[model samples]
Target chain A: MIAVLGLVVGVVAGLLVRPEVPAAVEPYLPIAVVAALDAVFGGLRAMLDGIFDDKVFVVSFLSNVVVAALIVFLGDKLGVGAQLSTGVVVVLGIRIFSNAAAIRRHVFRA
Target chain B: MSDHDRTNGHRFRAELPAEVTAPPSAAEETPGERTPAALTGRQRLVKGLWPPRVTRAQLIVALLLFGLGFGLAVQVASNSDGDSALRGARQEDLVRILDELDDRTQRLEDEKQGLEKQRGELENSSDQAEEARKQTVEKERQLGVLAGTVAAQGPGITMTVQDTKGRVEADMLLDAVQELRAAGAEAIQVNGVRVVAGTFLTDSGDTVSVDGNKINAPYRFKVIGKPQDLEPALNIPGGVVQTLEKELATVTVERSSKIVVDALRAAERPDYARSSSR
Candidate 1:
């Protein structure tokens, strides 16, 4: 519940302040956002399973965004940035679907 | 290890009883609780990924989840509001948009071409009107020269009358001037005085006055016309030279290649002489 409250507050603050991302880092924002989404789903599933670890969630969330951006940056150097971004999105999307399914089962008990 | 050993191990695990295969509950107090060694590989795998414990870890996990949710919201907002909407568009949508833009450009180019054609036609019509105006101005200049309101120069004849007997009258000079006019004289001057349509001559007793200017004996007349026609007109039998010679005056006519008639008259602006349509 506190986590949900923090999310709402952060969103409101972000909207009000409207922080501008630097031009150099702008290319990575979409990928980082997708990675952050994967971490949120994983965290939700963990919370539902009664094994929600704050340290693990924070570490995983930070690592997911960083690693996703790093992969794209490296792919750009290799001239495969688009393909790498697609691969990352596909993997993260599958994970999100599975975690969402688990959360649904826990909530509905079906 | 190998595929065969893995298959055999899976088969043995499948043969275990339901009670032996059940997961160990940490909270349950039972006498026949299974040891950690009795846990299956699947159970261990699940435990590694998700630890069923509520502790300080929840705080860190919750904070990170909050951050993730915030980032997601911000990303969504920025993506919708930013200038790079094409980055999120599908390939087919981008192609359709490009086609529409090309069509619009082609239409604009055609419109511009049409306007350019119209401008060209307008310029052509204006050029024709200017040419016509120049021709009219040239016609007016020729008319002004003939009417004696403008100066004129051309091949013609000059005549001089030496009336040693003082018998030459203004009427006789007037007759000579009329004869030149009938023979198509473009311009004429008598004794430094211009001759025009409104010119009047009078006998001034031993002199002739043309347009209120008196000219003495040795009356020289400069006439501008076709030299062939003017010289023949003066030499015609019973013409002005013959009549003037009978009056005891020596008349001489000479043809010249260039004769100047520098005379100007102000054009009349008649308030009552408006042109009728007929």
Candidate 2:
């Protein structure tokens, strides 16, 4: 439930800062997914360590998502959505690799 | 942690740090001590990532997250039940607009051809039908006046847009005005009212009201700016006309030699959008 409550950190923040997007932004959906999953993985790690502090997790999750989104938005504003999304995938790709390694150890260790 | 483990009739060995590996059986055991494998922080990290089996904590967190996500989805879903209605309205508006554009575009083209013929006549022969001549001159005056009003500069530009079907919306108007402002327009007026942050949108089933004024066509707008600055405001890509070309709305812009935009009253605030910090 705590992890569940933690996900609101993104949704509420999303509605707060996410502008009413037009259909043109459909392509950036994947970047948003990566950012969300990154937050989830990071949150689960925090919970297991007995450090599931709401403020830290929520703020961290929100900022992480927003910063990624904002960069894309800025790129969109600057007419560079495709390039910015590519930039996002590069950083998120590295984070995904690191996070997957962590998840592997978490589940398989005896 | 153990150097060798026997599991399911197979022996497996691991290379681990001294703290992580179990001590030799000959070593004296400490009283009330944790297992040797528990000594390494890295092992704990590995264990947290992929335990051999699921833990109660993981189940609780997953269930909780799903429930919360569902509840939020439901809440937002209920509130936006107007999506269908909005879509319907938008479609209806679009159909009406296309028809109007078809008719108006043809009319404008015909008018342009007529004006051209009139010009050709003046060049070829001076004498023309007086009544036809007067009517053409009147239209020219209106267009000229409006163009001049947009060109003049004291404050801003007012663009009055309306649809015969009463379908022009505040959002549409807002978008156009925003574009104009973005194009360096100092200020703007729509339907004789000033554009300000507090400007609101209200619907009386047909016409959408702006700033509490029951404005209808012929939507006359006046602007105060250099003709050069204001004209470009209306021509940018994806600008005013594109946004507001809804089916039931007809937009006619006139720039007058001396356009008067009445000082407007403060508009009411919208309740739907709230401040982020608040």
Candidate 3:
């Protein structure tokens, strides 16, 4: 019961802590979407007993979202606002692969 | 070691039945049993950025990581916001500069139009002067032809007047020329030079001059008028000679017959009008 409570609260708070976006941030909204997917996948993996590699899930989800947002923000500053989204997707994809492996490990344990 | 490990939880669970393998329902638990407390959401988030474990060392590491990540997020957000504001300022500056350039270009176009108009006016005046020069050349050519044709004609009239007596003035010569022209002269000359509408006179050395050529006593002026009307008009009582001789008291007049003047010849000109007529 306690473990389940911790998971529910962690997931909910993660969802709610979304920082305010700016108009200059509009081009980066797609990166935000990828970050959202990373969190959703992490939560779903948790629910399904897909992988309980807590470290993997937290680091992957955090770095994917945060680094993606940072790259997009940096690209906007560098005047190549469109290309930052590519970096966002790339980092998100890397994090996704790492977490997916963890998911597979526990879920497909032979 | 055996004495300290005697009351452990593992030893207690080992004493329970196989029913313990199944999830423990509320009905299976003894009433008022103590349950483990759940960690708060803030505690879970603080620990999330760290290694997955629970110990004094791990907790300390988790707290450090949480501080680092939190500080990084706040700093990045603040700095990026400032950068965004600066970008907006640059865009505004660019737009303003473009507008100024547009305004300058518009003014330059207007100035160019005004200069073009002035240039057109100058060109028009130049073209007029060129046309006048061409007409003067044509007239000079016609006069050359006239001189050739009229060389054979003979017998003309002559009149003379002067300010040598210190009384006649430049107007006296102009008056004489006017009267000769009115008397139906075909051609006239003053001081051995052809006199036309462009003739001018000025005073020099106590005598009035014609076309800058001087004359002495009995200044010889010639005219080719029809003899009958030519002599009668001037010799009529109280006429031009009477008037001029009365004033200068040194003027003279003379007339003759068989005066000759000629027609100016012209070379053929291309009739572009015919080809362009239609």
Candidate 4:
């Protein structure tokens, strides 16, 4: 309940302020956002499975964003930036879809 | 019970050592209460990849999700703003813009038509000027022939003065030439020399010279004119024929339908004389 309240407050604050992202972080923002979405879906799935852990959720959320950005940075140095980004997006997208499907099943019992 | 569980079980065994392996449900329990040594490698991997139910982690996750939602809204707003340049305009402004565009198109069309009409008029005037130039050139050629500046051929008379003893002086021949000119001789050639307005006759030893070109008898004159008028002008009493006969020169005047005076003289260009410019 406290988490949900914090989420609502954070969203309202973000929309009202409309903070500008720095140029250096701009490239990583989109991938970070995708990783964040994957984390959110995974968390929702864990919650429905009666396995939700605040420590695990926070760790995964932070690691997911950092690792995804790191992989893209390394790919850029290796001159395979675009291809690696696509690979990450595809993997994350599949995880998101599966997690969402699991959450739907747990909620609707269909 | 399902193939999914069996596959997960195999993955767990392959990734985690037997001693570090624990029940998967350990992730749902209090994360702080469990010892790190009791947690399995597979459970640790799951904890790293998924969110836990702890208050602090959940709050952080929710905050991140809120940011994601805000970013999406911003992206949507910016995108729509880019395409909404004219969308914010009033109905009257849009109508006025359309009317202005129509007026511009109509003006351009009218300008094009006017230019086309001007081009047509210019073409017609140029064609008329070209025709006039051709006619002027033809008139100049005719005038050149009449002036004895060009060769001429037509029906006329050929007079031969047989002066065997060379009694015919240049003055008497000059008189005959003058008479032919008065009788409307279009072109005249005397002793192969073209007789123009500037021609002079002079006696040279035993022969007569026309324009400094000496000729031997019998002196032949090819005259381009009306044959009837030319023959009569020579045969009239006290004319060229009588004067030549009295000089003991046998003069024969023949009327032919075609006489060619193939002699040319350069037309003089007057430096000071010009046509009056109206």
The candidates, ranked best first by DockQ, are: 1, 4, 3, 2
TM-score of each: 0.56, 0.29, 0.28, 0.47
Candidate 3: interface RMSD equals 14.6
lDDT of 1 by residue, B158-188 (tens): 9999999999999999989888988889899
Which ten-residue region of model 1 chain B has the weakest summed lDDT? B1-10
> What's the residue-level lDDT of B215 in candidate 3?
55
Better of 3 and 4 by lDDT: 4
| Residues A1-110 of candidate 1: C-alpha lDDT, one tens digit per residue | 44555677777766776666566676687899888878787766554444445556676778889999999888778867778888999998997786666555544433
- Per-residue C-alpha lDDT of model 3 across residues B178-214, encoded as one tens digit per residue: 7777888657766565665456888886676776777
Runs of candidate 3 with Cα error greater than 4 angstroms are A1-110, B1-152, B162-164, B248-252, B259-278
**Which parts of model 4 have CA positions greater than 4 angstroms off?**
A1-110, B1-109, B270-278
DockQ of each: 0.15, 0.04, 0.06, 0.11
Residues forming the 10-long window of minimal summed lDDT in candidate 2 chain B: B1-10
Question: Which pairs of residues have clashing backbones in candidate 1?
Answer: A53-B57, A54-B57, A54-B58, A54-B60, A54-B61
Candidate 2 lDDT tens digits, B65-118: 443344344334433657633432233356777899999999999999999999
Clashes of 3: 3
- Residue A11 CA error for candidate 4 (Å)? 31
- Comparison by TM-score, 3 against 4, better one: 4
Candidate 1 docking quality: incorrect, acceptable, medium or high: incorrect
Q: Which stretches of candidate 1 lie over 4 Å from their true place?
A: A1-38, A41-50, A53-110, B1-89
Cα displacement (Å) at residue B211, model 3: 1.7
Give me the displacement of residue A76 in model 3, in angstroms: 99
Instruction: Report every candidate's CA lDDT.
Output: 0.74, 0.53, 0.54, 0.74
